[model samples]
Structures are given as C-alpha cells and as structure tokens.
Target: MAELANCPRCHALFVKGPAIVCNDCVKREEEDFQLVYSFVRKKENRTAAILDIVRETGVEEYKIREFVKSKRLHPAQFPALSYGCERCGAEIREGRLCESCTVSIRSGVQKQGELDDLEARNKKEGLGPVTYYTVNDDNR
Candidate 1:
C-alpha cells in the first residue's frame, strides 16, 4: 500500500495518511492560518469566539476551525479571555459550544431548560417547601 501523508489541514492520515496535496496547498493553508492567527491575536479581537472571529475576519467557520486545531491555537493566553456561551459562560476553547454544553444538549432529545422543568414539576406536585427554588422576594 502507498504510504500515508499529512492533510493540508490536519497533517495526519492512516496508512494512506492525509494531505495528499503538494507544496502549494500547504503554503496556502499556512498563509491562511497565519492570517487567522494574526487576527485572533490582535488586542482588539483576541477574546473573540469562533463565530465572532469568522464573522469579523470574513473567513468561513470550517476553515477557521481547521486552522484552530491544526495550529493548536487558542484565542488568548488566558482561557477566560476566550469568548464563550453568553448563557453559560463556558470556555468554548475552539468551537462555539463548549463540550459540556454540547453533551448536555445531546443527552436530551427535546430542547428544554436546565432547571425550568424541575421547578415546574415541583409546583405541579405542590412540593413547595421541599422543592428547590427561590424563597425570598423581598427577604433578601
């Protein structure tokens, strides 16, 4: 069998590895990566998320994702600096959704609130005091 080669994007493959393209593809990919990395590293945009980076730079998410992984890159030195879910504040690392959020979403078929359903159930069953919920309106 033919020896594997690195993909221009990932630089990895099985016995017949990836990156079958010649030097030109590699060079182009590298240039694109530099462009993206440079943009992401900018002081004004270092904290941008994957979508923000793509939208701001006009690069496709697909290419941006590839560059992020292939380059082993981060939006910023501090993980907290990286933009993430507005709702959960999860550290996305690369993609828009964090691993935890993704798992949480996948675990349930129907999209629903994290705690809304439980609270609704407790109210329905009249398990008021035992139910987990806020007890103070003005007592705070």
Candidate 2:
C-alpha cells in the first residue's frame, strides 16, 4: 500500500510507492538515465569510467552509482562503470565490499572468534586474574 510522504528530491508531497521520489523527480531521473545511457552505449565510451560518463552526460555520480547498483547499467558491458566498496571506497561491480576488504573483514572476525574462545576457556578453567583470600578462624 502507498503511504503519504514527502519526496526526497523535490520535497513534494507524494504517495510513496516502490519509488522513493515523486513522479516529477522520477521523470527527471528517467531523462538523466537516458542521457547517461546514450553516452555510455557507444562503443568508444564502453570503456569510459563513471566520472567520465558523469562529465559527458552532466549526470551526478551518485545517480550513476545507483544505476550500476540497480543493474540498470551492467559493468560487464561497460568495463569501467563501477561503484565504490562500502568499506574502502575501492571500485567494485557487485556487493557492498571489494575482495580485499571482504577478506580482511573475514580474517578479523575469525581472529575475534578465536580470542573469544580462548577467553571462554580461560574463564571456565578458573585461569583468570589471581585473587588472594585470608583465613579467619577466630569465631570457630
């Protein structure tokens, strides 16, 4: 069901549906997409990077990135069209993080798990920090 909300792009009140923007903004975005598409569809421009496409089409970088993310622009067809990894800002065609960052994060998580396991073992074995206790037998 559509809900009433303000459009993010034009600040117009619109019934929010599948699209987050208003109808006017959606039309404008379609125009921008066409411009960007025409520029990149050419054989020579197939190897053009995202910045190059943005410069030629006068479209914003984020919009181009969105196109790539949505698979509206296939990076396989246009070798240079790519968005940044969410972690290290390296250019990537799919997923949030690039290969190296993913590996690094995975390694970090594994190490953390190892540390946690060791700590748990130490705790279970009563091998934690030393404590002193004094004997008091006066009451007895």
Candidate with the greatest TM-score versus the true structure = 2
Candidate 2's residue-wise lDDT over 1-140, tens digit each? 76999998889999999988999999999999999998988889989988898778899999999999889999889888888899899989998999999999999999999989988988999899446898899977
| CA lDDT of each prediction against the hidden true structure | 0.62, 0.91
Clash pairs for candidate 1 = 4-16, 4-17, 6-18, 6-19, 7-18, 7-19, 13-17
Give the worst 10-residue stretch by lDDT in candidate 2.
126-135
TM-score of decoy 1? 0.41
RMSD in angstroms between candidate 2 and the native structure over all alpha carbons: 7.5
* Reference-based TM-score, model 2: 0.80
Which lDDT value does model 2 have at 80? Answer: 85
Off by over 4 Å in 1: 1-18, 75-140
Worst 10 residues of 1 by lDDT: 78-87
C-alpha RMSD between model 1 and the true structure = 12.2
Cα error, candidate 2, residue 23 (Å)? 1.9
